[model samples]
Target: MSDKIGAAEDPLPLRWLDHVATAMNVTGSSLILALMVLIGLDVAGRNLLGAPLPGVPEMVSLSIVAIVFLQSPQTLRAGRMPRSTALLDMLTKRSPRLAAAIEDVWDMIGIGVLATVAWATWPRLVRDWERGTFIGAIGDFTAPTWPVKATIVAGSVVLVLQFLARIWRRHRIPDGKAQ
Candidate 1:
């Protein structure tokens, strides 16, 4: 584990999480591209032949949802989520220790919120699966939504773990240096 951590500036677990996030983002991008191409082809076929593509809207909608959920973890890992840094920056300038403590507390609260939301929504996801909900023009195009919901929950879990890792690394660092 130490060797793995030493191989990268980040801890091993965090690095692995980052890798997963990156992969997911790439996959999501690919899906988006495919969706665009599909839509373009469908439009061209309809305009040229006067025959509309069946279930194109439905497929695109599902693909968009998947892309959003799948890319969430990568966004979080990149620290791109919006946050209020006014108070944090002020505290950091005044007292480094207090700033660190506040940061840890903020991370904890974020983790708790994300975990609780994921936990609460999990049952609904299962119920949706059990009920066999389908979204499309025809019922035959049924694709289970549970997998996308599960991806969201999994992304939150990964974010929580990443925050915890950040807290741990912060403790390892001295007063004014990187860990």
Candidate 2:
């Protein structure tokens, strides 16, 4: 492991962002634990008796997306995103500035993509919220769909902000220490 445990490189702007992302991560983690408990109960119910949790599968399906999006911005912030960097790696030794520029370009693209998604999803979220749309058996075990859609919008906005923060942080890094 790298032996650098000092405060974040750009701590001020990111402090709030970090806290928000951490909160999102905690929320996602709690959901995961809840899912496990739910699945365990479901399995026990199925095996011990003939009845099982209604809409467990549906709940899981919805939660999977929520979990992924919830955790993604934090993952991106951590520099843990799984990206193929063969070209960037090669460029780093030969042309560090170029590599940094390319990385910035990628961040710009990411910002645009994320912004577009947030834009697109907002209307759907509003419609769902306004209409009180839901999923699963209507009267059996329905869950409000807006919350998940809102999560999507929130996650997308966080990612966009994170990408912007990354770009800002990148520029703040000294010329010789750009990484």
Top candidate on TM-score is 2
TM-score of each candidate? 0.76, 0.90
Q: Could you give candidate 1's per-residue lDDT for residues 1-179 as a string of tens digits?
A: 11112125665777787787788889889988998888998999899998767778877876776787678766665666678878877887898789888878877998899799789878878887898776654644556667777767776777677677657766765456663
Clashing pairs in 2: none
- The clash numbers for all candidates, in the given order, read 0, 0
Candidate 2 runs further than 4 Å off: 1-6, 9-11, 173-179
Query: Quick one: best lDDT, which candidate?
Result: 2
Residue 131 miss distance in model 2 (angstroms): 0.7
| Residue 101 Cα positional deviation in candidate 1, in Å, after optimal superposition | 2.9
Clashing pairs in 1: none
